[model samples]
Structures are given as C-alpha cells and as structure tokens.
Target: MNRDPLPPLTAFPPVPFDAPGRTSPVAGAPTLSQLGDAARAMVPYLREQARNTELERRVSQKSTDMFREAGFFKLMQPARFGGYEYGFTAFIEIISELARGCASSAWGCSLGAIHQWAVSTFPEQAQQDVWGENPYAIMCGSYAPAGKAEKVDGGYTVQGEWHWASNVDNSEWALLGVVFPPNEDGTSPGAGFVLVPRKDWRIEDNWHVVGQAGTGSKTVAIDQPVFVPAHRRLTFAEASSNNPPGASVNTNPIYRIPFLSAVPVCLASPMLGNAQGAIEVFEELCGSRVTRGAVAGGGNRLSQFFPVQSRLAEAYASVDAARLLLYRDTTEVEKMAASHTIIDVPTRIRNRRDHAFSTRLCHQAVEGLFSSVGGAGLSLDQPLQRMWRDANMMARHISLNWDAVSSMVGQYHLGLEPKGQY
Candidate 1:
C-alpha cells in the first residue's frame, strides 16, 4: 500500500452518526453476515418483480418500497440524517444481497447510496442543504464529467446534460459534473460533480438500451442559469487528495478514505452483488434442473458432466474471491475511518484497480455460469439470463474498464506516473 503523510485529524462539529436510533436501525446497521440474510429475505419478492422490472423499463415502486420498508436507503446516510452510516463492507454486502434479488434494484440502491457518501464529502453547507430538508432524502448521481459551469458570485451557472441517472424516480436530488471556468485570469477550469435539486432539472426519458433497462437511467438537463450554491460543488482536485470536506464534519475514517475508492467502489459493488445473485441462480439450477441425456446430460444437470461441475466451482470461487477482495478493501476503509487517518494515493489507486477487478471477477463468474447453464441461461424468462445480460452491460461501464484500471494500477506499482481521469 502507498503511504501518504498523515494529515492531522481536526476537530469537527457534530454529524449525523452522533444521533443514534434516528436514521439507522437500532443495531447500527447490518454487518456482512447480516446483510446476506437481508438479501435472502427478499429473494422471493425480487423474483416476482424481476420480470416486471425488465418489462416496464424500470424497477417497480413496490419493489423499491420493499427496500424503503427494510430501511435500505438509510444504510449509507448518516444517522444524524437518518442513515445507518454503516461500514463500507456492510454496505457492499447489503447491495450484493439486493442484487441477488434484482440486479437493477440492487444497482439503484448501491449506486444511489453513493450520493450519501458524496454528500458527506462536500461542504457542511451542502450537507445542510441536502439533509436539512428530509433526513431520509437519498440522492443518486452520474459521475461522468461532461458539463460546463460559468463561475459567478454565489456559485456557478451550471448547464449540462448527464445520462444514466438511475433511480431517478426515487431520488429528489441529482449529482452532475460541471467544468467551471477558473477564478484566476486563466483558461484553466476545474471539474467535479455538483449537487442539483431534482426540481431544477427536467428528465429527458432518453434511457433506451438493451441491458440494465430497469436502471431508469434517463438523461437530465439543467437549463437556464442554474444557481448551484458554491457549497454544493466539490472540485475533483479536492477529492483527488488533501481536501475532502467531509473529514472536517463527519470525522469518520471511512468518510476520510480516498475518492478514487469511493467512486469505483460505489460503481462496482452492485456489479459484484449482481454476480452473487447470478451464482445463487446457478446453484438453484444445479440443485434441481434436468438436462438432455442424449446430448450431454444424464438426469438432472448436476449429474450430467464434470465440466459443468468444474465451471460451477469456478463460478462459486470467483464470486467468493470478488466478495473477499471487496470485503478486505472495505474492511480497511472502515478501520482507517475509525482511526481517522488519510489513505495515500497509491493505496487509493490499488483500491481503484481492485474495484475494476471486482467487476471483472463478477463478469468472469457470471460467464462461467452463463457458459455452463447452456440454452436455459439465455431464456429471457430465466432470471439467470437477466443477470447474465445485466452483468455484461455493467462490465462495459467506464469505471470498470479492464484496460485502463490495469494500466493505471500497474504503472503505479512499477513506480511510474499515475494517469487517471475521473
């Protein structure tokens, strides 16, 4: 792990977690073991909604309501603000559990939760702006830095369009990337995602794609000169290192962890969850499904061939490895957060690479299951098939790209210059 000089821990004001039994459950939220059980609790309901979610091009309100009733959104938000403020490991486990039930729903919950972490990263004013209204108000964001903001007095005039705003229906706020013109007499501008009220923007209903369709990832446009109070914006440079605003207020070591880890972990955790869901499906099939003996099987597919058995083992192991990798990283984050220490750039880079690998491992595991399940896996009616397609679509996300993460991580390991855009 790369070690950066530790910044002195500062005395900050009271935060959400200070208030117990407010936002989170009495148990202080679920651990990895507990979160797995929560996911299992929803399996029947998720199976019922899986097809409906896909058919309607969005997750059903009923399914998400189940999440709400289960106190899902509060898992990541601050307790003062009605969140569990649980460790990242618990969050990942819960997300994986949700994905097993319905990948899209899990994606919504996991990706949507990032807004909670992101909020804690911004100015106290920004945090107040969000939680000051409804403590349970959850926000979802698309971190793609592809918008423009002209600097002004209070804040910048933000105007941009962003896609993949998942869980738009459930969130009242959104995070948009804006490149603001420099304050100095130079053309150099800064880039970062800014918090925008859902009311200030218009949904474009432009999310039409093959996979993860239930993500409801529509395009959002912020027209006119939108006033995004300065506090609502966090510069990428600050998040890059040395200036995370949350450390001043939140004081949690997890909150003090790297932004690189924050973003990719938010993105890939759901994918890992979804892959675990796929493994559950494969296991179910293994237990009971029969196969054609004339071609490759004897009775049930479990007794058919040793090759599939090997593939199933690989799939199981891949998921287990992915979970363990993520578990280890988040465990360290939780530990560091409690200690209130700063995680260095190289460690952040490793976390990023691990995040990317988490997705790849998920893909590989799903592929292992997909290849073995044969024709049954491709049936749209089969839940495994949905997971298969969903995993493939998720793999292509920019954050999870194989080549970039590997090259960046490898160079950092070799003591080469770090090159990362966003």
Candidate 2:
C-alpha cells in the first residue's frame, strides 16, 4: 500500500452512519445490507441468461425490470427522489454481485445506475428535470467530449457523436461531454458535460464486440444540435472541486466524495467480480475433469495435478487481495467524505493508483486459471470461455491499464506532476 506523508484528516467531525436518515427529509429508505441481499438473489437469473444476453447484444428486458423493481438503480440515488442515498460500498457490492452472474450485465448496471448518483450531484432543478416525472428513469453517458457547443442565452447548443454509451436502450437521458471553444477574453474554455433527453440523441447499432458483448454499449449520435440549460451542465473544474454547485442543496455525504478519484472504483468493481466468477467456474469444471491417458482406465482427475492446485491457489490469493483492497479503500474514502475531510492530493493519487493495481490483480487471477483450462474451455458455448473473454476485454479499459497507472503513480511519488486523467 502507498503511504501518505500528510497528517491524518482528524479535525473535521465524522458523520454518523445514520446521519443520512436523521438529516435527510425523505423516509423509509432500505439499508445497504438489505439491498445487497436483493442483488445476490438475482444472480441465478442473470447467470442463466448470460449467453442469451450476449447473443441478443443487450441485457434482457426481464433482467432490467427485475433490477428496477428491486430498487438496485436507487442504491446511490438521492433519498428525496425515492433513493436510498447509500455510501459508495453499497454501489460497489451491488455491481460486483451482479458481475458474478454476468460481466456485461454488471457493466451495464454499474454504468446506468451510477449515472443516477451523478445526476443527483447536479443542481436541484436539474435533478428535478431528470426524475420528477419518473423517479425510475435511467440515464447513460459518454465522457469523451466529442461535441462542440456554442454558448447561447439560456444554454448551449451541442452536437457530437459518442461511442460506448452503455445500456442506451434502457436510458431516457444522456450526459454528454463537450469542449467549449473560447471566451471573449481569449482565455481557454474548459470541458464540461451537458445533459440531453433521449429525444435529442439517436442510437447507432454498432456494439458488436468479442467480449462484454451484452453491454449494449452502442454509439449515440446527436445530428441536430440540442440546447442544454446552463444548470444542467457540470464543468470538469467543478467536478474536481470539494464544493460543487450541488453541495449548496444536496447535503448528503455521498455526493461529497471526489468524483475523479472515486468514479474509477465504480469502473473497476465489476471486473473484480467477473474475475472471481471465473475462478469459481474453473474450480467447478476442474473437479470432475479426467486427464487424458493412453488407457481410459488409467486416467487421473485433473484436480489431483500439482500445477492445477498451484494455479487455483494463486488465482484465489490474487482475487482475495484485490477485493480486500477495493473494500478497504472504499470504506476509508467514504469515511473521509462523511467527516467532511478534504481528500488531499496525495490521497486522491493513491486512490487512483490502488484502483488500477486492483484491476491488474483481477486480470492476473483470471488469466492464471484460464491458461490451465483445456481445449474444451475454448468452446464458445463454455462458461470458462465466456469468463476469459469478458475478463480480457475488461482488462483493456484505459482506467484499468497497468502501464498508465504505474507511470502516473511513479510521477506523483517522485514529486513530479502526474499527467494522467484522474
């Protein structure tokens, strides 16, 4: 673990676990543990339809309906709009549990459900515009600033093409990133995200991929420019600040955590679960697998092999370590946010470093078990093959890439400014 040189942030008071319930105006929200059980119960159904989900190139409507009915989407949403407003751990666990069933489903749920929390952190009127008519409305986002927006009277007109907007089929709104051209003073205009309704964006059916095929991560294009209200926009500078515009009205501690540092955890959580599921599937298959021999009667069980045992042990260790670190960092960050402590620069960088490292461990765990599996594991229809494909593709995400994280972390430790996006 990376150690921080700064003194502990102990001066600010810590918010009690029940603080949200006592302070929040809303009533009767379910606890985080209760929501975890709901997620765990849905695993079997998700697992049963994993292949079909990939075949259809999207999560089944049945699964989506089940998730909505179970209140999974509201885990991180604000209490005022019928959400539990739970801490980050609940969100991580919910996504991880769902990933154990299907990585693509978990990816879609994590991306879609997390947007609810993101939208809540926006201005009050923006939140109302999103959830007032329908509290359960789902949203999607593309963070790459593919559009150019002109600053107008009430808002900006945005037109951009965004790819990998996961689970767009289930979303009624989108948060698209755009870069401002320039200001009248000739200063650089920074990048910000704009909110648009589903009617303004069109989905392009272009999500065919080898791994995580069921995510429905299709392209979303805005051909005609759409006007966005200024209140609905959040700048990257605002996101990096301790006090955002929403902090004036959204008093929940859940919204206080640093976005750039904490959002990576959400992206990495599902991959960890996918790797663990791979190990579980490997163990189940290896138990009954008989080694090929000159004579059928002389064949030995694959589980008895020393190499197989070593691989299983190694994979387990890696996955367990990864999960422990994920939970540990999450709890620490949540505690800091609750206490109204400013997450210093060093701590934020450390969070980014550990998240990427954890993702690397998950990939290693999956690869170790995958390599030991026989040719039967290569079959397209095999569960092991599916896990391998999903895990491999997941490891390829920019945030999870080991090389980028290592460089950024090294630069920070050396007292040099890190270049990577937080």
Instruction: Specify the highest-lDDT model's number.
Output: 2
lDDT of each residue in 202-286, candidate 2, tens digit only: 9999999999999898999998888888888887777767677777777887687777767877778888888878877888888
Tell me the lDDT of model 1 at 12: 19
Candidate 1: clashing residue pairs, number = 5
* Highest TM-score scorer: 2
Candidate 2 ranges with C-alpha deviation above 4 Å? 1-26, 183-186, 293-298
Writing each residue's lDDT as its tens digit, candidate 1 over 71-153 gives 77766676667667765666665676677778887888776676787788888889888889877677768777778887788
What are the root-mean-square deviations of the candidates from the true structure over C-alphas?
A: 9.3, 7.5
Clash pairs of candidate 1?
A: 16-80, 23-82, 96-273, 253-337, 254-337
Clashes per candidate (backbone, < 3 Å) = 5, 0
Task: Check candidate 2 and list the clashing pairs.
Answer: none
Looking at candidate 2, what is the lDDT of residue 88? Answer: 68
